[model samples]
Structure formats: C-alpha cells, structure tokens
Target: MTGALFEVTFYLAAPFWALMIVAPRWRWTTRVIGSPWIALPPLLVYLTLAPGDFAELWTVVSRPDLEALRAFLSSADGAAMIWAHLIAFDLFIGRWMYLDARRRGVPHLALAPVLVLTILLSPIGLLAYLLVRAVTPEARRLHDREREDQPAQ
Candidate 1:
C-alpha cells in the first residue's frame, strides 16, 4: 500500500480503538477494544515493512504492477506507522483494563501485584485477577446487596 493509504488506514483504525476507551456508554466497545486481536492490523502493516511481501499480498487482490505500493510498504516510514498503531492500541487497551479493574473496586493493595504482573506477564496477571475477583467475599457481598437493593420498576 502507498504511504498515504497506510496513514489513512491508521488514522481510521486508531479512532475506532480510542472510542473503545472513551465511550463508556457502549459496553460492547470494551470487548472489541480490549481484545488483543486488534493488534492484527498493525502487525500486518509491520509485516508489510518488507516491500516484496507487501507486493505478494497485494497480488492476491489486484494487479501486481503497482510498484509504488511495493515501494511505499518497503520504506522505513511504513514500519514507523505500524509501530505507532501498535503502541497506541496496546496502551489504550491497557488503560481501559486498569480503569475497569479500579471501577470494580479491586483494592489498590491487592491490585498492585496484579498490575506489576500484568505489565511483566499479561495472561497470568489477568487470570489471577479474574480468580481473585471471582472468590472475593466482599465483592460477592457487595454485588449481592446491590442486587437485593434494586427497586422494582
């Protein structure tokens, strides 16, 4: 893809991911935004940093004679573009997870070690937090009382 097209794609995708973070009213957005699979676009772009590979992929869709597309993808600028997208998307997802944890009343002390672990090893920290949240008596009680307190409407 040409540099301009790559930039446009990044611009479009970044805002969609950002909306996942900032738009709290839309809960489903969280799932879409937080899924690490969103990393694919930038990863694909990163793979395209080698022009020959980019051309090969493009050839699957259209004419192979688009040498400009190949050159653009091969450039260092393309790699930088991919890097920026990956970093922004990852940070947004991380921030969203942190905020969600805090909103759930995960205590700062309990959350500290998890946060550290998440930074160093994401899956383990996430699983640990899920297990802890699941079994936490206080969390259970709070949820139970909240449900009990709900007014019939």
Candidate 2:
C-alpha cells in the first residue's frame, strides 16, 4: 500500500505539471490551474499516511536529532508521506509560477524550462524563476509602477 501510494502520488501531480508545461497557453490549462485545490489530492494521501505513527512523526519533526529523523524517513510510510507532501507543494509552486509568469508577460519559452526544473528540483526552479522574473521587462515595470504609487516612507 505504501509503495502504491508513493507511486500514485507523482501520477496525481503529473497531469497538472503537464498542463503547466505542455499546454501552458491553452484556455483549458488556465481554467484547470485556476483552482488551487489541485494540490489537495496528494495532501489527502499525506494525511492518510500520517496517522499510522503520529508520535514518531511528531517527535522526528519537533526534535533536532539527526538519527531520529533518519529513522523516521527510512520507513516506507514516512517516505511516502514526505513524497506526497513534496508533490503537493511542488504543484502549488508550479501553479503560482505559471500564473505569475503569464501575468508578467514572461514568455512561455523561458518559463517552460523553469517549470521543468521545478519538477525535478523545486528550490532551484524557484530561484531560476525569481531571476527570470527580476529581469523581465513587464514585471520590472509593474514593480516600479507599484513602488511609485506607494506613499513615501
């Protein structure tokens, strides 16, 4: 069951990722991603796997011990739970990146690679998007305009 859940976790997130990366400009893509609840299914899996050993899970997280954390994650259930957590958050982040990039007028060509990177390594993908967003003309112009409108501090 744990193995199956782990496998299914990525499958659940894959369609969303596909929409964001493949058919990014499609009307259906925007409509589907418009709902942030897309992240819920994997989270449900996480919740299901969590109750099995809540005490160990809590202890591993609440304390700073390396070995305890290692032991907890070494278990099948623990690994599966973490995988679901990662999938849910990654999809959420990808959704935000897609919507924000489109709004900022960052071309889909540039955003596609970053979205792909997010699937493999989200922190790095987020960093890359930040750099891209920072340099994008529309995004920078919008930021400057917003700053100008703010009351002087």
Candidate 3:
C-alpha cells in the first residue's frame, strides 16, 4: 500500500522531469510546467501518509528530538512521507532551474546532468547549479550592471 504509493510518487513525477530535462524549450513542456499542478501527485502522497499518523507526525515535526525523530522516520509511513516530500520539492526545483537556465541561455547539454543530480541528490545538484549560474552570461551581465551603478569616490 504505502510502498506502492512510494514508488508511484516518483513514477508520477518522472514524465514532468523528462519533459523539463529533455525538451525544456518546447511549447508543451513549458505549458505543462506552467501549471502548479505538477506538484499535486506527490503532495497527495504526502497527504495520504501524513494523516495516517498525525500524532507521530506532529511530534516528529513540531518538537525536534533526535531519538523520537529517528524512531518516527524509521517507520514505513514516515519514510513514504519523506520520500514524497522530497519528490515534490525536487520536481519543483528542477522546473525552476530548467526555466531559469532557459532564460539565461544555459545549454540543454549543460543542464541535463545537473537535473539528474537534483533528482538523486538535491543539495549537491543545487550547489552545482549555483556554480554554473555564477558563470552564466546573464548573471555576469547583472553583476556588471550592479558594479557600474555603484558610486565611486
């Protein structure tokens, strides 16, 4: 039950991920991502897992204690909730990165691998995006504009 939803969570998001990564500039890809509903499936999974154990969920989140938190996450439902949460956030972040990259003229070839890293390990992937973003012409231009606007003695 929960396991199936757990697997389905990622499966549901895969198509959106594929479209954003594979056809970022395509009209349909932009159309699909434009709507906020791309996050609904994973959020639904989180809703399913969360209310099942509200007391534990509340405790795990509201009051931070290591031992209790560890026990809570060790449960199947806890794991599912976290998994769905991760999937939803990762998808949203990937979508943002994709659009931002497109706006900045970052090459699709450069972004494909970074998006994959985001799917697998979001923090590292975000760090990579930040590194790339620093070197992007858009960012450089923005920086130059800001520097020019500064007052000199």
RMSD of 2: 1.1
Model 3 lDDT per residue over 56-138, tens place: 98988899999998898899999899999999999888888887787766778878899999999998988898778778787
Worst 10 residues of 3 by lDDT: 137-146
For model 1, residues 17-131, the per-residue Cα lDDT tens digits are 4443345336766566556566566555555554544454455337645575555446556445545445445444454555555556656566556645554455676787676
Q: What TM-score do all the candidates reach, one by one?
A: 0.38, 0.95, 0.89
Best-matching candidate per lDDT: 2
lDDT of each: 0.55, 0.93, 0.88
For candidate 3, the lDDT comes to 0.88
| Backbone clashes under 3 angstroms, per model | 0, 0, 0
All models, RMSD in angstroms: 10.8, 1.1, 2.7
lDDT of 2 by residue, 29-114 (tens): 99999999999999999999999978898998888699997888899998899899999999999999999998888888889999
CA deviation > 4 Å runs, candidate 3 = 142-153
Best by TM-score: 2
